[model samples]
Target chain A: MNYSNFKIPAVAVALGASLGGLVYGYVNEAISLALEAATPYVEQGFEVREDNWSGEVEPGKPLLVKHQLFRGNEYWFWAGTSWPGATIKVDIFDSEGNSVGLESFARDSFAGVRALPQKTATYLIRVVAEYSKTGEGLTDEERGANDPVEGVGEFSGSLDWGLVYGYR
Target chain B: MVMIENVIRIFGRAPLAGLGAVFVATLIFGAGLLNAENAPNAPERIDLSNFPGEMVEKVVVPIPAEIFAVLEKLDEPDWNSGIELPEQGDPVGERAILALTFGSLVGEGFIAVQAKNADEIQTIGKRVLALSEALGLAAAVRPHSLSIIEAAGNSDWKKVRDELDATQQTVRTTMEKLRDDELSGLVSLGGWLRGTNVVTSFISNSFSEDKAELLNQPGLIEHFRGLLDSMKGPSANSPQIRSISTGLARLEAIIAPSTEISEEDINQLRDISRTMLEEYYFEKKAAETGTSIN
Candidate 1:
């Protein structure tokens, strides 16, 4: 039997096939893992917390900044950011977009407000970051004024809150 | 004659041609199986670019906005009157807000969970869907609430109370659905979350623009109800839900306003959340060593 021709070719072919299989497997697996790694960030939500926004509280339900500070939960309070003797109103809606609760706060800073449920849902809570910095109640002009009141820093963007929800 | 016989014998005994056929067949079949398995072809890169950036924005942004709107509505009874009270709304509204808040936190926590766990983006999508379902439930109960509000608008207190009762029933049912949906199988996790991101982003943008606040709007209320009604009979239980529940719980708890927490406190909590998530990853790996991820 002339073994030389068969043996050499067989060994070469086997080595080439093994290399091809390894390369094919490696490339596919690597790409799959990379894609898998990117999935979550592409789908994750914000951890809304208290620090996300500032607001003024009226005489009604205070602006509860449902921030995802500690974990991605929702927390409520009277008002977020306000000057002394400011009036702010906070309104909360349920998942069904119903007005479920309300509260008011009249204080300089709502630094001491209590924390309510931290659970985050599709719940939307809007804070009327209003304040009567003027000695008298906000005049029609003052109320309509876009500028932040006298002696009070700007409160624009006070409604900013964190977006929370889990993703893949 | 002897040589001829020997040649015939060698050819007959060796079966080289048959061996070659077997080799070719093995290669073809092996290649086919591999090809079939790889046929999925990496899901076509998701072209999230074509995915309507507006859709993602609508879904992701509104999640917080919708949750906050509910919180805001619950916190204040009247928008015109700047009056603050300890409590001034229906008790059912209070409970619904709490449950919705829980669901929202869970939704956000699910996002964080996937981020840390090194999972697929689809998991996040499913979470978004779960949140969407919750939003839908909230919406479903809205008609009842709206009936009450409308009756209240008409100064019909009796009708309002009746509607409130009806609203409560809807809420209880929705809550059960949410509890059942407390996270689950990988496919649902992926599909729902992906779809949710698109939906939430859409809602948020629409609300933000026209400068419309959906805080207590009837249209949004109607939307929620419509969504919930559409998804009532679906199953939400899956394996992934259990794995992510604890993390979600922690996240939900963390979102509540804390009198005792400071910046430092929050930072510490975040660190702890990360640590626990890492542990979960290790445990998951250990458990999944032999099972099919699919």
Candidate 2:
């Protein structure tokens, strides 16, 4: 048995398999982080509904989901991504394309928006994930000399995003 | 020596194959990178500036509690006046009928909670259990049913409401997991129809603009109609579904065009909802006794 010839190709196959597993693991982590972002609202007496949405989006490209929100109940929609230093945005819109979100905040890797709908109609929620080149919170030395940080920088590609919502 | 030579020849071919594996691996990794960099056909950006309100991947229907919460603000109507329970008897055998009955019962449970009618809530809880058993979801629903009874016993209206919501959600989720999506939609549809009937009846009594606005749910109507349209096999062709579908279309025609529902609109909706319940949903046992659900 000439086992020596199999060494190089076997290593390449193993490497590819590892990369695939890493991508899957990263996406799952993003989903968990997205749910974690809603903990603050949950503490504020918001009942997080079980229904949620998740998908991959290109950096700077926005994803939209439509939901029927009752007029009286207050709602909070939160989104998160696994990409480090990624800027995320979550907002709600009415049928007329008007911004109906009352309060919103976006930080690295996560964002949230609050909405108290004026009518019980199908409203759109827009979520955006963008790559941050300067790695906003990082120090200059951490930014690396020529390239961006490991997960930041010119690697502007699709990012996995998770969205969860709570109502009070 | 011949075996060694043959092994070397195989090794000579291994470099190309090794390169191919690495190339394939790099391609997989690069695809993820390239997709992020330049997502083909991906819209450059989505903003209110050019947002067409299209592309809706999911729609979450507002639970019955959400509307009940609003109705509470408009001056609590006599929720007891709206407490209409179907006759208690053997569980309906058909899954569709049982699903609708379960939904309507949950809706009634909400009203009972609002009315603070402990007895009615308890009865509704038992009926919910019966219907759930008929639908083969007794295990999942029993706990919620028991919770509803306990909450009603203590008069903890909020807990009762939560349990009711949980009950319907559990049924819908369980049905969906069983791939009975049509039944799941029916459960929601059943609850919505019952809720609407109560709301319209209450609004018609008071006839306030604010109260009437609560019935202005064209989106939900469309959603239920879509559910009906998506049904297949016996569930879709059932007389009850067909009747409700027609009734929903009529409701949609009236509600979709109006930003504000007139008193006339309220009466029409109330009548339509009541008729559907009496004819298709609530009157099953009543027909045998020469009585009505109310």
Candidate 3:
């Protein structure tokens, strides 16, 4: 196996192979570093809906009040009924806790309403529903029962509208 | 004496043979190692004619300014004239919200579609279709609903009220599903992470000042040019470079103007990606071999 004769070529091959590997590793590391350096700031997180329950609404039964929120400039709101057949009235408020306007709708007949503001901002909004045609306050018993509306309903767990400003 | 001489002759010839063998072997080994290191890791510039992902991001990323402008056009109220159907209320303003609803869903849809293991995307898609159908129906029945409100002579604009109520129901249902689905949260996170990619960052930063202006720059073309350069560069074999290039190439084709991304582009990308992988594997093998030898 006289290795002495094959020394030159063996060493050359080994050298070439090693150098190629080293170069490759270095380039990979460089590119990886570049990618790391260029990683953009990804603003991804739970779109925290800002709460603006600042103003007070007229405490009336079936009272329709429009609450303004400086939120959802890029998104819309749809109406949802707790029961299959229900009539719901939603009142929106502003940060000052004042009734801005009122929006009324039927649950089963239609989908929901969306409001697009001139600008983006936060607002204090609430929804209350009643079966009565008169805008009167709900009785304690009625309030205790399965209320289908958001703020004025028996089920208040899902009523809190966390309206986010941006489409996150 | 004869056997000894033959042994000496063989030994004498061994060095030259070894040298030739080493040269050939080294060249082969070096070529293989370089190929392993340099093979394409990314997709090539695709022909846009058959691209399926062109509007993928468009359907996902919300361009607020564009949407707002559209809304304003739809809802611009004429002070002198009375409020007409589309112009009377804020249906146009509503357009902004609509666009986002669809855009965000589309973005999430891509992630859902890509999920390693999850049917959440399908659920979301169903919700989207439902919402879309609901909106279409509402749009058609809106006039009828308004008539119901007006004929009753309800003062508080009951017509408007009823329509809004309907809209609220649909919006609530859609948003609820979006929030409730476990995958929604995950999708958001994934989107955020994807946006953090180097290519994304570069474009975001580049277009920060005026996005519209930036879009006008034909990013796809520029990206293609850069990609071609990267492919020809000395480090073209690097997997990292190849992957980055691949990402860019795919994105460029997706954003390009040829309508659909062509099959050619996808094939090229796949080929490049495969080559890059091969190069990486072989280079790694060579390194392991070298390490073991010394």
Candidate 4:
């Protein structure tokens, strides 16, 4: 019941959490740069005329935005995270709640999907990213083992991420 | 809770044991968080099953160029009708009008590009410069306007179009970053009105099922309605915004929850859009000129 003994360890725990937050901020900046890298490829021939709309999404939690996409125009959506070793999944859906999407993958912290609408109507875009240290994809045998990496340099960190899209 | 209370009582009997236990617990918690911060321990795959995504209130509607691209690909519509230059008159400026004017000017630039009128593009580039100056956003918009002028000089229509696009973007972006959400919304509304005015005009003239179907823009109308609904302070309560909201509602009622639109409906919506554009963009009296700004 001595309060004095709990002091040092509590301080250390509090300090550890603060330090984790600081590191997360820096890692987030790196992830932002990774997201920007995907921009040039998605925007090569397009003239974007609207504000970039983005929002945060956690791992396994998909985010959806409904947009009025006209038929006969090519539109692209890119989702990214600052969290390293995280893979993003994006799905485009119809009003009937049918999945009508195929995602484009880049090995970095971003994923995208480009679709030319068959009907000029509002479509829902769903984006999700998952955090895994070896998100680079696992081998059949690696899947069988609990720990895939024999020796790893660092532990994976996962954080919130966002999305941006445009039309030419 | 009872077990933890009992443990605390036991720790009271042995202070040294309590200290060791506290230290060990802290270390374990720290390590777990570090494991969270560290690499290998984070889960690698994302399971999207049962994932429920939340809605983002802010919506960026597709710009005029989106429809322009489709028109160009399907049929090369004449740019002359859509390309009429905006008149610069009655030069007593106000902030709200400037905000709306900035958007309309950019919309005019899009029309000029579609026409491939370099002179008109340069004219609009100048108009945009003046509006930005009036709004004190010249620093952000000046470079894009300059680029637009120079690009037009080289007859680089594509580059000119891009610069015009960039000019509007820079202005809108700076306004948003400065927390001038009202100005940003008006700017969007101005652009939307002008763009739709011309689009409906073009579609009306063409009058095909394919062209008319493009007016099935229920999403965009709702986006604008939502934008108007979310407006705060002056921008939200502006008479211009109120009228635009009323006009948008009229348009939305015709478009929403409907797979088809008749020529009459297109003309009616176009009339509403053009009338609203005249009042807001040109400051014209509704009866004096309900036509789209020229």
Candidate 5:
């Protein structure tokens, strides 16, 4: 009947369960809203006035978002996920994984990449969210010569992430 | 001393399990911190040249309003000029036609917002509700329709426009989630056609290369071309899709390489878009009357 009898093991179990749910809640809900919110920034900064394409994605497995970017329009692509310590990356690429866009912005929960397609072309937008410790110190320049996925560690399970894009 | 030894033993006995417990606690703690107001990790710009992005096959380009906004910036645009009332016909009978009709109605909704015409917005809003029901998308679409009507009444044209955009997005995402990709494609193509028909008319009359520059949408054309090729069932075999496929390819050739959006090309695109919109509605009406198109 004494409280001290159940101290360490019980506390550790309780902590584990609590944190697991906390991370899942953000992954399932909060981050998705953040991605949608980022859509407006494209509208204001680039004068983009409408929704184009958007889709749901999961972490671990990468998503290839193919969008038809016109020649003259400047476009912003946003991707996000809410897994604490999870990496969200949105990059534009060609068929051979070449850089179609030179810049992508990322934070703990989301990323936005901009591309001004010089000509009408079909480009791939890769959005990936994952639990990784390696990406913390690595800059894009250092990973510049390597495949972006090289540093991504494996985390398995079904999780929710989303990406949306707009153009001016 | 006994408690410390027991704790160590608990960890040592399940070392891998111990690391897992620590990981979970850390993740949960971090999540809690992030959930606190002022999430420090607000998204930032990532322009990593070396980050190779993968591609998804589906592609949806920007909508008409995007170009419209830019045009508004470029000059005082007479949004009312190219705006023509859609000829009212009994909502197309076929489900496929209904999907396209839904897209058309939303596009009309966008125009109504632009013209600030409450009457047209209300009419379109009701029609959108009816069509969504017919398409079995009532649940996904009801709120947007109601918002559209409510916004129309308030004369919050911007709100009306947003609701219309939301309406279309809801329908497309719903369709996509349900794996009704073909219907999703039709919704997008229909809205696009309506917008293009109006824009082409505006640009053709004005004939500015600057305006025509927007029509350099070969990427969208390619997307449509691919969409048509991917169609299945009657929707695939439908004369409507075949013609659209051929039409987009031709348009793609004109605009491909995204260079020199010629006046001739714009005029041709306008003609094609108008004809397609007309043919689609006409066919729907014809199907309803049990009559054949010539």
Candidate 6:
């Protein structure tokens, strides 16, 4: 079997296809998770916007999104990821880097932050994702086995995350 | 470190083959930590120009209702005074003009909702349908238009507001999907101009600092200017768009200088929006009537 000639192309095709599928699947899952996280807010009379932002994010690197928010409207921003054991932090900041987020929650797969803007201006929504081995419902032994360093655990590479918002 | 030892132990009998892999993984993990360390803290403003993470480029412009909702809380300016129904005219043919009209019509719908003017709302709904048809978006917009009329009839102002927001979103999304980015931008710009005109007029009438502060949206002005600057083809060179570009520049100059818009600034903003809208509508009418708008 002369498999040498086919090796490079085979690897390339497999790599490309897997990478594409992973990204697509993760993005879709992230969006769904974000919407799920927004369910409580929606139930509270917050109208979830149809548009959302999604992309790959390296663990621990913060993603900043500049958005326009009007005063007198209470807003909730939710972010989600499909990465297992992921801890997502979402917050809203003003132009001067002042934290304007009111109530915020972060769990394993999703997080949310609320903001009642003081002015009608451009705001920055910052999201950061980090992996936690213990948060995945792992037992003590499993956590100990998987955990490598003090803060470092299993590296999940870049994660796909989605962000959605609602206003009341 | 323990995991690395475990790996070494697992391959300990195999000439330290796992050492290289562990070292590489450590370096990659270290690099991520270094990047995280380099990132600005939450209280430090990020420099967007050198932003490293993937920035979601989509900027969702707030619909007129959002701003109107804010205005409702500040002071009870007579929203009815802002509701001036533009004369019902022929359907616009040019896509750019139609898009602008559609956006402005939606803005009018918002004002009508604020005023609780059922008849005006119904009229704007019909006009919106006609303009959407002219812009080749009748199918997507018809349901919303119908809903708008129905909601207005029921005096469900909130539903009408939602439908109007949805209608604008649908139109913008459809345009983007069809690669009509320019038309989509014009729609937003039109809505913004009309909304701004109404807000500025209302604030100028009452002259409140808080209400005037709502007009502190230099970023939005810059966004619209960027849209105008990015327009290509004949639409880019059209007198209407160029005039809009000039108007936006004037607005930016007025808005970018101060955090709080003064009464005079409000009046100027209102006049700029009013003049631009009047010129655009007048030019369209003049073209239709075979009369020069000199």
Q: Tell me how far the alpha carbon of residue A117 in candidate 3 is from the true structure, in angstroms, after superposition.
A: 3.4
lDDT of 6 by residue, B32-71 (tens): 2331212222443556666566555666677777777667
Error of 3 at B9 (Å): 94
What is the lDDT for B139 in model 2?
92
Chain A TM-score, candidate 3?
0.30
Per-residue alpha-carbon lDDT of model 4 for B1-294, expressed as tens digits? 433332332224357765775576456434423312121221223234544655555577666777777666555577767875556864345566678778887888888888878888888888888878888888877878898988887888767765766676667767876888777777877887788888888877777666677778887787778877887666567676788889989998889775588988888877888778766575456454234322
Screening candidate 6 with a backbone cut-off below 3 angstroms (N, C-alpha, C), the clashing residue pairs are none
Q: After TM-score superposition, what is the CA distance of residue B161 in candidate 4 from its true location, in Å? A: 2.9
Share of real contacts kept by model 6? Answer: 0.37
Candidate 6: lDDT of B100? 84
**lDDT value, residue A91 of candidate 1:** 46
lDDT of 3 by residue, A6-66 (tens): 1123433343222211111121221121112111111221121211111111222222222
Better of 3 and 4 by TM-score: 4
- Candidate 5 residues B1-294, lDDT tens each? 433332332224457755665466446434433422222232233333444443455465556676565455334456665555566666656666677778877877776677788888888888898888888888878877898999999998767866777788778867876888778878888888788777776777677766677676666777777877987787777777677777787778888663888888888887777667765753333323211111
CA RMSD, predictions in order: 31.4, 20.9, 34.8, 20.4, 18.2, 17.5
Per residue, candidate 4 scores C-alpha lDDT tens digits across A23-122 of: 1112233224323533454335544332444444445655667777777666666665544455665667766666555324444456556565767888
TM-scores for all predictions? 0.21, 0.71, 0.22, 0.73, 0.67, 0.74
> Could you report the DockQ of all the candidates, in the order they appear?
0.01, 0.11, 0.01, 0.16, 0.13, 0.16
Considering only chain A, what is the TM-score of each predicted structure?
A: 0.31, 0.70, 0.30, 0.58, 0.57, 0.71
Q: Which has the higher DockQ value, candidate number 3 or candidate number 6?
A: 6
Q: Candidate 1: DockQ?
A: 0.01
Error of 6 at B208 (Å): 1.0
Across B1-294, the per-residue lDDT of candidate 3 in tens digits comes to 433332222223366654664466346434423312221111223223443221111011222222222222223212112100011112222322332233334333333222211244334434444434543434433333343334233333222222322323333333434443222222222222221221122222222211112222123334333533534334445454455346545545543542432344333333332332222111223322111100
